[model samples]
Target chain A: MIEEREIHKEYEIKENPLVDVAAYLFLEDIADKQGAAGMNNYLISLATSLAKSMPEEEYKTWEDFVESLEKGESIISTFESVRAKTNHCMVTHKCPFERGWKEYTKRIGDFARVHKEVADYYNSTVKPGVNDTQCIICQTFRAAAAERITVAKKRLKYAQLAAVAPDGSKKIAPDEWKPILLEKAGVTNTDLNMVLRNNACIWILY
Target chain B: MLDVALVSLIQDMSEKAGVEGTIQYWERVGESLAMRMGKEAYMGWPSFNVALREGRTAYSIEGDVTPLTDLAVTDVDGDVVGYIYALKTCVFEPTMQRVRYSVGDVPQADAAVAEEYNNSVKDTAICNFCVIHQKFREEVAKNITVADQPLECVQLADRGFKGETKIARDSLKRIGINPEYVRSLLRNYACVFAILMKGARLKGEEEVEE
Candidate 1:
């Protein structure tokens, strides 16, 4: 028989809370007020603004810009940039938000319970569609993550032009850069859409 | 962590088959390893129980719960069920070292090496561990007898979320769970919940003499 003492002994350990409950509650409150879709939009916009906050002068080229993004300590770890055939460069990394959630789950206990609670709250309050099995919190987090990539791509495009022509005399239209970037990065529109929509690890950057 | 030869092989595969093909090849490697290791080494019930016991004790005392080894399992009641041990540090330490090394600023080959290594490799490694554990569960169905009742291990996390692409899809399908989420728990971790439940007989298994 499994002794109660053994079970109790095993159940005793706990870790220091990595994230403050108050912070989580605060986010939860905002999520509650905004509802699912609104909160998702809000998160994406926040990520966009955060990406834009990076100073452009620090980077000489698109590569420099991409390198700078990974300089600081973050919840996300393990970043790799793989250059495929042609001009396609794939920047892949583990999702930081997902890592944070795992740590948070370790501290709190039971991922399913937490997921269910959040899902229940959203389903009851927001009235999800019949086919919508998607978790609101996950959707919101993923949107924000995908937005970061999108904004970074835009910034990289500008940096690419600046690298080619430092002087203001040579003018390259922003619209033209989009196609040039697509060709240079060796990524098609479909690839970009898939990466964004799926929150894929690989980011197409030239 | 993979050996230098394996890493070179992966790189070579990437060159020949592209990123998607390389990832697929890696998945096959993991599956083969799992098969070779056998069921007990990869998915023994006792091993999982011990891991859970150790994890709970480690976490309760505010001890350092090493990733890929000490994983904390939780149940539907928001209670910590127990930890399921997966890989030792020795198993993936070299890989972590490679990640650290790759992160340094150095232009290598056509790609300018980024500051950090891609975590997909680590995630895939952990997923491979899960694949091994799942293989046993699928084949045997019931491999252990606890308190005179036969018990089967049920993984809380779906086994379909094995590779990076499938993991990405599962992240959306299962809400927030992804490869990173699994790897963060431990290097070689299994997120099993059913075996930790109370009263095995109540779950409808025959009570036999131990």
Candidate 2:
């Protein structure tokens, strides 16, 4: 009754750090490549949504990640400095995303070093031309990202095109729509803000 | 006439970007935009100074034909120098996607697709030469050179480029080459014999060689 794609996919992901890393890369690739990276909060939500879909039994948590380091099982465990501080972040305060997913989590001291390997591990899902295990998953993620980007673009366009404020309290001139459109598009970071600013540029010659 | 401001921009960007590569890229981008807007649309730019119109027109004409393979011009002070390849091959585009393949380049419509295109009423070709046609840019890069100019951004637009196509078209009508041979060549190779041999040659015009 179920399709082949549905069989291997876990509906509710466990609090495994390994799985979380994979989901992070997947979320980033979809959003960044498809022009949805501007929606920072939306991207975090999408990652959470995707992370919430896998089975916990198959993955490891932040505590487990630290344990793996001590045991020298994972590539990430080799760094003693980063592993030294993991317990405190795990015991005292959970990172924002991890707050809901788990009761306890460890903070990565050398996040940059850890992320490089995490990215590599995530990319290991494919062997280029030979085998692509994540092809279907990537397609699905891109489709989702495209939908989000389309909605965001349209919402911004509507804000620009609207003659009056949403509350009907004030009328907006066509020339004044640029700033409002940027705000509506959620241009928080430098990159997305640049994209928004570029849309308003028009060269006048003479 | 020259475009002083544009040259300044390109030169400035190139220096800041730390490479001549970037400036060349920007010029190519400008050329592509001009080609897309076309001569009519470019002249319609209301803010452009009346004095600069002639220079703009010349740039537009060059964008239309030169480097049919890519940005065919070099950005000068305020002017652009372009070269239209003076090939004698008939360049036919029965389909927009398959236009890169020159089947009738041999003074006759020899490619099967060419024959089918010439005879059929359908806009799309029965045989899609897209795969082979796609490689034309890279091959052109590897092969063709006019003076020392290199095409930076090769592309085919919706509006067909009529280069040396007329001569080749006339040649096809004059000689009676088989459509099957043309099609086989197109299917097997990206270009016809004549086009591959001395393709996209831009020199002073002369009588048709073949």
Candidate 3:
């Protein structure tokens, strides 16, 4: 069995605190300008733009998509398959943005001045006058970060569709992919919200 | 380097208040430590002048006093961005090492605690765990101007033996250092200084003859 320390060592090697700090600062900047929902939409839009810009041939298969995503500069660490059963694939990878926000909170002892809604949500969930790691700000960043994976999966599904229908008569609209990806992953809004808030690393997909 | 009691207090404060709070608290500690070290510990150009007068190209101090060696870090354009200090013969190596080891020993249940411990250790280690502390670097950077441009965004970089030799060698070469003395210093001390400062953009660029 692979020892736990060995797994930690793998993470340690990949942990770039500087990158994390930069990401955290970026998130704080965005959150300050836009509300939580605006931040979410911005991230989704950014991911969609990134996905649209990628070479279509690179995401022809699920494995190919995963490989391409891993190679992308935005990804902090390598992904590991946690579950690979039939019709179900779950992978986990560390998010440096989350790590950076966590570190910021631990060191600076206060959340970056964000929109009132973002701060309000965090305040409502976590007790007042306490600054522990249960950060909604980081969670927002993590949820937005997860949009990249969703967009990639949608592109892969579109590729599969294109392969089946070579005539290109049928098409899935960009707006339709969010529900489609979620349905394929067998995830509900509650499940996704839970994953976003707590387990930001794992991505479940078909 | 902080004492055991201070480290523990900072660790506890880190747990309660977060790393940012701890850093703010650490600044106070640095101030207090600087006061305790007395007037001689404060580094100035006179110190550098004294070293030059003594026929030493690099700043060197003796005895149990904290040794602060100034280093000018340059950019790709060869412009002096900021300064760093090398703390030779670090007295708090044992304490810093103990704190580093204890990070591993922290239970998996207390992952946050372990992370906080690790960060605190890093913050101290960046200053070479010297008694002079991190604030001194900031204080010095604030007063420095390169090519008539004041330095801004002074930040502390990592403190490790990894690239110390190269940094020390490069900085020393810039000032036309004594090779034999530097060779002996590196051979004995192993470049235990923490680097401070980030690159600053000079207002105007002067064309160079290639």
* Candidate 1 residue lDDT tens string, A1-206: 23632332222212112222212332344356666555444333433333232222323454554444443211111121222323334433223234334444454443323323444454455433111212232233223333334333353221221111111112121465557666766766566545434332333333
Task: Kindly report which residue pairs in candidate 3 clash with one another.
Answer: A106-B18, A106-B19, A107-B19, A107-B20, A108-B20, B1-B130
Local error of candidate 2 at residue A127 (angstroms) = 22
lDDT per residue (tens digit) for residues B1-210 in model 2: 001111112223334543334323323333332232222222221212221233332221121122122222222232233312221111223221111111112211123333343344223222212112223222333332223333322221111223211123332222223334444333322233221112333222212443
Each candidate's fnat: 0.01, 0.00, 0.00
For candidate 2 chain B, the 10 contiguous residues with the lowest summed lDDT are B1-10
TM-score of chain A of 2: 0.19
Please provide, for model 3 over B1-210, each residue's C-alpha lDDT reduced to its tens digit, 9 standing for 90 to 100. 012212333334455666555455445444432232222221444444344345332122111222333545455466545443333443334333333422222112223432443466432233322323445343433444334443332222223333333223433443334445555455555333322223433222221211
DockQ of 3: 0.01
Q: What is the lDDT of residue A33 in candidate 2?
A: 40
CAPRI-style class, candidate 3: incorrect
Worst 10 residues of 3 chain A by lDDT: A159-168
Count of steric clashes across candidates, in order: 16, 20, 6
Poorly placed runs, candidate 2 (over 4 Å): A1-34, A37-206, B1-205, B208-210
In candidate 1, which residue ranges exceed 4 Å CA deviation? A1-17, A20-26, A52-54, A62-88, A105-184, A187-200, B1-210
Output the number of the lDDT-best candidate: 3
List CA RMSD, all candidates: 21.6, 24.0, 19.1
lDDT at A107 for candidate 1? 46
The TM-scores of chain A alone, one per candidate, are 0.40, 0.19, 0.41
The interface root mean square deviation of candidate 1 comes to: 19.3
- Estimate, for each residue in A1-206, the C-alpha lDDT of model 3 and write its tens digit: 23643544344334433223323343444455666655544443433332332223323466655544444322212222233221432323233234444544443345544533553444354322112222222233223334444433463221110000111112111335546645666656455445434332333334
For residues A1-206, could you state the per-residue lDDT of candidate 2 as single tens digits? 13421321121112223223223333333344443322233333333233222212211344554454344332221111122222321110111223211211221121222222322333343211101112222222222322322221231011111111111122122344445543443432243333223121111000
